[model samples]
Target: MRTLTTRAKVAWAVITVVVLVWALLPVVSIIATSFKLPSQLNLGTFWPKTWTTTNYEQIFAGSAKDLFLPALRNSIGISLIATFVAVVLATLAAYAIARLDFRGKKLILTTALGVSIFPVISIVTPLFNLWRNIGLYDTWLGLIIPYLSLTLPISIWTLAAFFRQIPWELEQAAQVDGATSWQAFRKAIVPLAAPGVFTTALIAFFIAWNDFVYGISLTSTSAARPVPAALAFFTGASQFEEPTGAISAAAVVVTIPVVILVLLFQRQIVSGLTQGAVKG
Candidate 1:
């Protein structure tokens, strides 16, 4: 690598600091607002005049119709189930595309890629009708199936790229040692693909957690509504007023798990992204 000039290095450092502040400003604002009392927030400054936990206490006091807790539980349950199902199905599908030489494979891969490019609105109506007929409407299963449409293609594509990077000779050698295809895959391929699997699961989890359109359009009851759907209640047409501080508190609550997941998987995400780009 060539050394950078002093001017170039200084300019790059300035750009990095600018970008970091740009990205973090909104997040810092949200967290700061969440800790303020409703009265303190009216002052309109970056920092709160008074810090209090009443916002969080009110949320846990069985007020707010228990919306916060239920929404939290629904989001976690749906995201975990959807992520598990999507990752398993995607892994198998990707393995076949990467390792097998079947007819129509190219067409299948192309179609999967095409599906990923389509917007969710394009099929929302049809999916709603189908779920209604099957009696899965407004149910966790209903939400899960639709979430698969959002997550599956991307998961398959990510895993397929990773699978292709593994040396073919390893699988061939396992076969020569009297292991069946499935056995060789389980014993050798799966372990090597752990990082990719974790990356796919993280993507699926976030997609399911953050989804709003289908969650709102399909579920009519609060019992089945996730955090994204529940957050809508904070905004009312008659703005006599909902507490901005409380809404910010709820947002902070919903964001915590996602932030934790990203931090925990930061290394894997970086590795998977670089590996996929370089290998594919």
Candidate 2:
């Protein structure tokens, strides 16, 4: 690798710092606000003069728990279920799309592309009425089903791209060595595709977890409302008080799982995304 000149290195460092600040500003602001006292909320600075954990305390040990905890559980359950279903279905469909030859394959892919890009707001109204008619409104299943529409197309696309890079010869070679079809697939093909599947699951989970419009528009109660929507309804100490600190605290709390998830699986995510980028 060639070394960068001093001027080029300086320019790159400045760009990196700018990008990092731009990306992390909101998160940092949320974290900083979460630790601020209610009186210091509008201090017009990043850090608080008198830090307090009252917002977190309220969320965890007070009445807010009734709303926050249930919503947290709903978010976790819904996102996990959506991710599992989306990843499984996407894997099968991706394998077929990448390896099989069939009529209208391009059409199916094009349809998926269209559906994925379709504005979700346009359907919320019709889906709201349809879900109420079908008895699925205000239910976890209601959210999970809609989340699939958002997640499936991207999952299919990503997994299909990654699947194309895998060598089918490995599966055939395993079969020739007396392995059964299932065994060969599980032991040979799956290992190669696991990173892609994992990456897809992460993507699906994030999509489901961060969903706000559906979480709010589809559910009226905490019974099915997720953390994102629940946070919107958080009440402050009094009617006149702003829930900014509580909102920030809740935001920080919800973000922890995502941070942990990325920290744990970042290597797999990077490998999956870059799997087909370089050929040697």
Candidate 3:
């Protein structure tokens, strides 16, 4: 294999650094803004002249607490439920697609791809009306169902690809030993598919968590409104007080969990997306 020359390596390093800065600059700015006192927001500085936790307090315990807290709970509950359901359903469907030599397998995969790429905006209006008529509006189930639309297709695709890479012989061996089909899948296939399932679960969770379009259109009251949607309801204490700092603080609060999840599972995510099970 040809090794990278010193000059080429240096060039690659520079490009990497530049890309990192470009990607992280906005996030850093948001974090800094979250710590800034509202009074210093328009001071023409990249960071606050004097930092304070007043904004954080506003969201956690002060005026915005009622809105932020409930929304936060709704977001966590809805996203987790969506991820679990999507992963479970996707795992079963993908296994069938990969393991069975049935007709319409290609059609199933293609339909999932199409739904995953479909424009979400086009469907929101219809969903809004249908949800209201069907009495799903402003409810957790309402949001979870829409979230499945956003998460399920990609999940099916990801797990299907991963399942195809898994050797079927392991499952056969288990069955040969008198294990039932479910037993073979649960004991043999599931253990090997863990990394991929975990990665897909994370992806589904993130999709549901960050969704603003569905969250905004489907819900109204804080009873079911998620953080992404509740942010739109944020108001200043008075005409003079700006809500920028509070909004930034809330953004940071919601973002931390996602960052932590990525940090904890970075290895599994890379493994799932980039590698398949080793074949003998």
Candidate 4:
């Protein structure tokens, strides 16, 4: 490998530092704000004058528990269900797309891409009315339905791309060793696709977890509302008070799962994304 010149190294280091500060400043601000006393909120200081855990306590121990806890449960339930369903369906569909010759394959891929980029707002109004009429509104299934719409397309595309990179010979070899088709697939194919499946599951979970539009628009109560929607409705300590600190605390709490997911699966995610980008 060729070494970078001194100037190039210096420039890259500067860029890295700038990007890190730019990305982390808002996150740091949220954490700092979450620890601030209500009286210290408007002090305009980056750090709290007197740190307190009141905001976090309010979310879990105070009146906000009714709203936050159920919403957290709904978020967990809905996101997991969506991720599981999307990955299973995508895996089968992607295997077909990657390994079989079928009519309309290109059309399916193109449509998937188009739907993934489709403006979600355009259909929200219609969906809202339909969901209301169909009795899915304010229900866990209601949110999961639309979340599949968001997650399925991307999951299919990513899994299809990953599947294309899997060598079919392994599957065939298993079959030659007297394994049935399903056995070969389950034992040979799925194991090789584990990384891709995991990465896709994480992506789908994030999509459903972070959703605000459908969560807020389709659900009216904590019954099925996720955290993002619940955060918007967080109340202050008093009628005259602002909910800024409490909201920050909830936001920080919500972010922990995403950070942990990324930390745990960083390598798999990177590998899944870059699988087909380079040809050997």
Candidate 5:
């Protein structure tokens, strides 16, 4: 590699600093506001002289009826269940698409891709009616099914791409050793596809977690609503009276788990994304 000139190096450093600050500004602001007292927030300062965790305390103490903890629990439960179901279903479907030769295989793949691209709003009304008729409305199962609909297509496509990267020779050797196709898939293919599966699960989890429209539209009771929808309760009709500090504090708390998960699995995400791109 050619060495950079002093001027170029200086310019590169400035650009990097600018990009870093741009990326982190919102996060920094959220954190700063989380610690500020309610009175000091609208003053618009980078740092607050008086800091308090009273907002967080009220939330944890269960004093705030509109607090996010219950919503957080609901979000976590729905996201985990949805991700699990989506991953399993997608994995099996991807295996068949990738490894089996059958009529309409191309059509199946195309349909899955088509489903992935379709606007979610188009299906919401019908899905809501269906759930209501089936007596599944406002239930975890109801949410899980819709969440799966949102996540499944992408999960199938991503896993199918990753599955194509696996060497067929391994499966062939396992077959020669008297292993059935299902056994070979379980023993060999699944192990090799762990990273891709993990990435798909995480993506699906985040999608389910972040969804506000469907959660709010489909679920009427606070018991079933997730964090994103629950956060909307913090807003008032009048802008001037909104609890910006409490809202920001709740947001900070809500975002922490996701941040921790992403940081923990950063390597797996990078590996899986690159593997899918290069191999597929």
Candidate 6:
């Protein structure tokens, strides 16, 4: 590897620090806002004058609890379900693409790229009407299906790239040693692909978890509304006040699962990202 000169190193360091601050400033601001007392919002300070946990209490144990907790549960369930289904289906499709040199192999990757770039807004209105007619509107299944459309294409693309890099000899060796094709895949390929699979699942889950368009446009009630959507309905302490603090608290709470997942799986995530192919 080429070593950077002193001047180049300093420039890169400054760029890294600037990017970090740029990306993290909003998160830090929201966290600070979440800790502030309702009256301290417009105090024009980055940190609260009188820091308090009232916002957290409101979301967890007070008036907004009903809206926040149920939505949290819905977001978790729907995202997990979507991730699981997407990973399973994508794994199979990717394995086929990786091992088989059948027709349209390149076409599959091209289509996934196209679907990923397609505008999501264009489909929402049509989905809204279709769900209503099919009796799926405002239901967990309704949201989950839309989430799949957002997640599956990318999942397939990532896993296919990763799967292609895995040594074919491993699976072939297993099959030659009396293992069936399914056994070879389950016992050999799946174990080796765990990191990539897990990383893909986490990415898919985040996509579904953070979704607001489907969560807001498709669902009408707390029954199926995710946290992002539920934040819109938080009531204020009084008619004169906005629910900014409560909303901030709910946002912080919703972000915790994502943070924890990353912290716990950072190793696998980094490994997968580095080892997997970045493009079709």
CA lDDT, candidate 2, residue 105: 72
Give the poorly placed runs of model 4, Cα more than 4 Å off.
1-9, 177-183, 271-280
RMSD of 1: 3.0
How well is each residue in 63-101 modelled by candidate 4, as lDDT tens digits?
688888899999999999999999999989988999999
| lDDT of candidate 2 over 156-240, digit per residue (tens) | 8778878888898999999999999999999999898887888888877888888998999999988899999999899888898
Query: What is the lDDT, from 0 to 100, of the residue 255 in candidate 3?
Result: 90
Q: Between prediction 2 and prediction 4, which has the larger lDDT?
A: 4
lDDT of each: 0.79, 0.87, 0.89, 0.89, 0.79, 0.88
lDDT of 3 by residue, 42-117 (tens): 8879888898999999999999999999999999999999999999999999889988989999898888878888
Show pairs that collide, candidate 1.
none
Model 5, span 85-121: residue lDDT tens: 9999999988898889888878877787787678878
TM-score list, all predictions: 0.87, 0.92, 0.90, 0.92, 0.87, 0.89
Candidate 6 per-residue lDDT, tens place, 18-51, comes to: 9989978998899999999998799889999998
Could you tell which candidate, 5 or 6, scores higher by TM-score? 6
- lDDT by residue (41-87, candidate 1, tens digit) is 76879987788876777666635537778877877888789889989
Stronger candidate by TM-score (4 vs 6): 4
lDDT of 5 at 77: 94
Q: For model 6, give the 10-residue run with minimal summed lDDT.
A: 271-280
Candidate 3: give the clashing pairs: none
